[model samples]
Target: MPKRYSPQVRAEAVRLALEHVEAHGSAYAAARAIGPMVGVHYETLWMWTKQALSERAWRAQRGQSGVATPPAG
Candidate 1:
């Protein structure tokens, strides 16, 4: 079976992915470059970053409108 990572590990991976994306200007590129170094698959890291960014966008939108954002899957 594949190893399971803790929430903190996942969060850190997402954070790293985000920083990589910001620096590289592409999530795919960021994942490809940083994933292996971080011990995560590129596609997995991409998905985590995508979800984190979406959640942040949702929260920002809700904050602006004073409404709650729906939870992401």
Candidate 2:
């Protein structure tokens, strides 16, 4: 795997990117706005923001009794 931004820097970049998207309503646009602040390409910034949002959503509903896990095939 390619060495990219530090984890802490990536996380902060993601947070900032999310805020930008939430305010501006577009991930690409947000990435463009945020790319310079952090040393990441717009595509990487967008991917990081998406990954962070997905993780947060997953964590918010983790371990709920009513949620079913699919059986391994």
Candidate 2: C-alpha lDDT: 0.77
Reference-based TM-score of each model: 0.82, 0.70
Please tell me which predicted candidate would have the highest TM-score against the true structure: 1
Error of 1 at 47 (Å): 0.4
| Tens digits of lDDT, candidate 1, 1-73 | 7777788878888888888887888888888888898888888888888888888889999999989968668
Displacement of the residue 60 alpha carbon in candidate 2, Å: 3.0
C-alpha lDDT values of all predictions: 0.84, 0.77
Per-candidate clash tally = 0, 0
Clashing pairs in 2: none
- Candidate 2 deviation (Cα RMSD): 4.1
